[model samples]
Target: MNAWSNDGLWLAGIAAVAGLTASAASLGWLFSRNRYRAAVPDSSYPPEVLESLYHHSPIAFALIDRQGRFLDINRDPADMIGYGKHEVSGKPFLSLIAEDMQEAVRGLFLRALQGEQISQEIKVKHKQGHAIDLFIQTSPLIRRGRTIGILAFIQDFSERRRSLERIRYMAYYDDMTGLPNRQYFKKRLEEKLASARMRGSMLAVCYIDVDQFKLVNASFGRDFGDMLLLQIAERLSRSLSEPGDLARMEGDEFAACLDNLSSAEEAQERLQEILSVLKEPFELRGVPVHITVSIGVACSGGEDDAATLLKRADTALHRMKENGKNGYLQHSEDMDHVAMEKLTIQHEMRRALENKEFVLYYQPQYDLASGQIVGMEALIRWMHPERGMIFPGDFIPAAEESGLIAPLGEWVIEEACRQNKAWQDEGLLRIPVSVNLSFRQFTEKNLTSKISGILEKTGLHPRYLELEITESMTMDVERASQDLRELTEMGLHISIDDFGTGYSSFHYLKTLPIGRLKIDRSFVRDIKQDPSDAAIVAAIISMAHKLQMQVVAEGVETKDQVHFLRSHRCDEMQGYFGSPPLSSNSAHALLMEKVNRPALPAYH
Candidate 1:
């Protein structure tokens, strides 16, 4: 059938598939009238009997003359069109259908009058003035083998049409985010690709995955996670300026196809704009949390298929993850090699855990006033059997990408505590040992119990165990505050690391049970060259003291930095200026020599 043909079912409603050919009852009804009859009237029923049956029937019925005029509309049909029977007796049948469908209705009625009975679904303007889907059946009336008029029946199909529309909507849309689902997105992407090809225009495909999104869900809760996804979807949908579609592919993963780009740089600029927008903090359930998205982009090649383009984008996204996330990367042929290496690192890190190949190196923190070392922050080192020694910066990202951070973080805690106990047993200084915790560790439901178990197993006093978390960890103000309180009650100190580079408010910093703040190394690296760095460090020290919280200046490698921190009365300091991260034995040698070295170059 032609596209415009309405012969078959429209929405699978109750119409009984009835034929619209002239029926004997319809012929009798048309001929019941004496004046307008083209032939003899049926004696079985008078015009009054036919009128009563037609008016009382539930089905909306109308009679039209050969010219498609509404010769008569029964009470029910007239009510369907917001009119009295007397008001529409001579009006055209097209007046009842929607304005756009009036011409089509005229054509259909003309065909019926010419002996072509028609059954179809159409939309009509209802009595309440709203559009409604209706199943319409028209039968031609004949008397003395001459056609005079027709009988029309209409049944409401609005409810059935709505149900079918809802089903189709769910099939093509993401329920959590309301963006297009992956399957529907593929169709849209292909269409865009074809348009780009036709115009010889560039296209860019971006694959975005929230960095550690599962951790956000697990830590804050599933409810907040869903809310976060919804907000992200809404923002991303509005972010597109070019013709595109943003689709939710799976948990924490979304993709987009951008076409009609003048150049690849345009796509990059647009994508960076998206990252900037997400950098703004999201407030969910009265708690503000920061989120970062890692994006991988691929510009169209002279010839590229959807599979190839999408795979390239995904490969770039993996590269972003391996290269320390929270950044974007354009796809390149060389990235595939990096992707394979990441896979290898993931396998090796897991195996390294079983082989006990991971080691902890300690860096000493010293009191600025006394010139005496206070404690050591434990940093992980991977002594890969084949690659020799691998730093945390090299393999930690791969471990995180592979979902190995939970086990790796727990191991660090256990090992650091055990080593601290071992040092105390060897008649060394019993300074508190701090271990960095990843976002993943924060999400562990039994994190408190797990830490308690580690302390028990290592026989280390809780007073000597410290956990260092980034400022980002505390962005969820309520959750982070409660967690910090619990950890403090358990006798373990918590330090907010990388203090100035996150979205946490000062209120949380002053109110939470955080024991200390570590001035980020970036600010310290340029303390002498940049006056702003010195001022920031001074301000941080003053604020920490005002709150009765200790301050630790990290990466303080210069004597000038040391003098600056001492003048500012910073509480504690760590960097190469004191000493680099040392092996366990080296750290113990410094720990055993616990004497307060006086008359220092800066401290004195």
Candidate 2:
């Protein structure tokens, strides 16, 4: 029994040893797995390994002390500053910084030491005395819950900053002329105006518009036009080189701000200089193109703000253009009053067509050869309740400005056609009725449909409807050709009104489907005395005849004018000599008399 008990104890001891060995191996495996998990996580990177990965980072890294001294630096900093790490350690950080930035560097270091982070993009001088922009971020390096040093990560940002500056410049300046654009100029002008008001300094704003730019664009292509504008910008820049600011407002317009000028005389002289430069012909794409500029000057006394000053300048510029371009005009109280009057007139004119205040008067077109009425031009007369009769010369420009001419023109067409039909129904002489067409009306969409609708409503034939358009109307050849062709196809007669007043291009006469050319009153009124007028009138008649078109002379007021027109074989005469524009009833009565009685003497 004692030997068996001893054997059991020995077996128990061996089993205990084997259990201890297995427990030891299991603990070892668990410890290894825990270490691996802690080191790798899901990314399989340890803290030390991740930190060492950027040890060779290209960015300059430095440790700065609280006293603005370099404590330690990475290899990149050593290479960047042409110094070994050992050489730079314990040196004053400001020693390596540029002299201009030393105080800033010290302030940054102090801020970082006070537990505040510092970040700045600044230019620094390299070891070779070359400047480089650096993006610097300095953070406090805390150790054992106490701030010890600052870690600065610096990246070379010279190229990046330069690129950003380029983008900023492009945003603020015109790409073609390099002048400040409207947005930037507005901001600058606002700032200047505020300053000038505070400093009690005089400020002048000039608005400039290039005259005949459309002609330039038409004669030359857009590319050549752009070149011309560039040359003009150069000249303007040179001319306005005084202590002022110049900018390209838009298109062919420019704006300038003159601050602290001694007197208005100085401003005027500056304007004259700019004008002189602008008057010189610009050689664009090897073509010597001439352009004149009209300028409007507005001072700060009349206008307190930028927008008002700009508006005043624009008003003055418009007046200059109206008075014939290539001159300078200063804004005055009278101009403001005139502008307000125009605005009131425009507003009233808008309601004119809708209020049924518009009326048409008939001016008889006399055929000098037969001494009989051939046609009558429908002249617009506005019968304002308070103002009585307003002639076409007064409200026509207003209508054109307000863009009411299109709808007004449609009304005129309907009224003229109806009047002509009424005359025929009254047993009066039936003759073609001519109506003036504005440029906008002629180019309006669905013009053909509008005219057709008018004819159908009035029961008047299209052959008796003559549209009188100006020479400028045919300048847009492609669009005008299409419109004229469509009007001709619809059996309407087209006439070029005010023939010699505009830049008449004979090239268009051949292509235009025109029926007649009306010599402008400017030439006819002077034809008896002015040699130029006589020559122009004769040439126009000859040209009209060669193009197989009839010639009509407008504004013939005297016997001599009528004789001259008849001697020149003019096809028609419509003026005071024939009959002033009369009321519809009076015109109808006259037509009836013409049909019943014999024709009048040719001279009468």
Candidate 3:
């Protein structure tokens, strides 16, 4: 009974244990499958779903293990580096990372694998022998509640980076000449200023304005002008001899920074060398064009920063152009003060022109052979309320420089004609009045019409007006001929003033419809004392007579000079020797007085 019952119980117990073990094994298998499904969230993991996402993504992607080793990389990233898929798989991702970006990439990847998402733009080296920019995004790859790898999304942005760089270059560079433009110049200058300040060193700025560049631009086509500018830039950049040291400030204007200069003299020497080089004519589009530059130099010292330095240099350049083009001037504090004074004068002159603070003074012009008052020369005077009677020497230049000459000249014409008409009405002499014209006014395209308007407004007879221009301006033959012909047709007298000093072409002189030639005072002042002066005066008188142009000798200060001029049969004379320039009232009174031609010793 013991053997049969024990055997049955053992068999029954063993069978129950086997059934429980089988159920437990089935439950464990279901739980593992659910966890795996939850981690992947896809029914098909490595082959269909994940592989599809990796291969079909717009961006390149890499699958990396938690240990930072590449499991697989897609074709796009592989092609970006000129590589095949098999060449990069199973490789250490860190080895592929650029040396400069290695630590950053490593930290970001580590963070991503630790369940933190990351994105960054990184530079990477390509197997195609170039470096490229990449936008990369990394996120954790999880399996069963643990991150097993990093999912990296990468995009090649090298083309976009190149486009941005191109835009930046266009902003900073001159399109015509390939030089740095004003904005880039200022940026580089500021950076250099900081470096110079740190080193306690001096820097010099040069403002070079090509003289008469407008003429070149007009004469040559703009294409030729552009080519000329390129040539100029090449020459100028050669002088700079340093990368990023030269820039084109504007049209026909160039600026340069001279760093580490020791003194003003050093700057002067360097600038002088450049000037000499500039003097050489440039061959532009088959034409050898002569060019000159007026350079202004300002150095850093005494709180002068890049802006101030450039400003001072511009001021000096203005002074150079004013004094006369084709030269260089180093700026001093005194020059800056002078520039400020000139600026103030310019501003004040503009206000004065608007406010009618200007009046004309008439200087008597006498016939040389007969000292009878033949005409009156209208001289400008500024009756400044505070400054009191600023002469032409004081403000005429400033007016010319500031482009106030046009308006100022207009005022002079109208006022002079009005005053002359008033004098004639007041029983004064009825001789035609002469008014000086500036070159700027003469060159105005609307000059003839402007004068006509002034004459009509003032109701002055064209026969009673005489316009005077310097001989230098008459050298502009075509314009002078055009203007003079118009004036002559209007019945106004046109005279070439300050003749002989300007070496003018006689061919052009003959073309001008000039009625008279006023030999400049330079020769007249010394005519009696110097034989050369006498000869020149005689030659001018004879030549003028041959051309049917009357001669007026200026500055007959002494009786000897007057007699000498008379001996040469010169036509006109007016000077302190006759009477100094007078106020409007005195000039009117003088005009009222009628006198015979003063008797001069007859020369046989």
lDDT of each: 0.80, 0.78, 0.78
Q: lDDT tens digits, residues 1-604, model 2?
A: 2111222222222222233212322222222334435544736544344234335445555656566676555444544555677777777767777788878877777877776657787666667777677888765654435565666767778778889999998878888888898777778889988888778888888998989998888888888888888888888888765523888888999998878876899888878888888766788667777789999999887338888899899999999999998899999979999888788878888787679999999999888777789999998888988889988888888788888888888899999999999888877776899999888888787888889989999999899999999888887899999988998999999998888878789889999899899988999999989999999999889888988999999998888887888788988888898788889988887887788453436653
Model 3 lDDT tens row, 1-604:
2112222222222222233212322222222434435544555443344334434645566667777876765554566876667777777877767898899888898787666667688877777766778887765654445566765667788888889989998999988888898899888888888888889888888999989888887898787887777888888787876858989989999999888877767887788777767667898767889889898988887666678888899988988998898988888788878888999999998788778898888888887655678888999999999989999998887888789998888888998999988877776677889999998988888988998998898888899999999878876688788888988899999988888877666886678888889889999998877999999999998898998989998877898898888877888887888788898988866666644435233344
The C-alpha TM-scores of every prediction are 0.58, 0.74, 0.82
Please count the clashing residue pairs in each candidate, in the order shown. Answer: 0, 0, 0
lDDT of 1 by residue, 133-163 (tens): 8888887766567776776777778888998
lDDT score, candidate 2, position 80? 54
| Order of models, best TM-score first | 3, 2, 1
Model 3 RMSD, rounded to 1 decimal = 11.3
lDDT of 2 at 504: 85
Tell me, by lDDT, which candidate is best. 1
Every model: Cα RMSD to truth = 10.7, 12.3, 11.3
Point out the worst 10-residue segment of candidate 1 by lDDT: 4-13
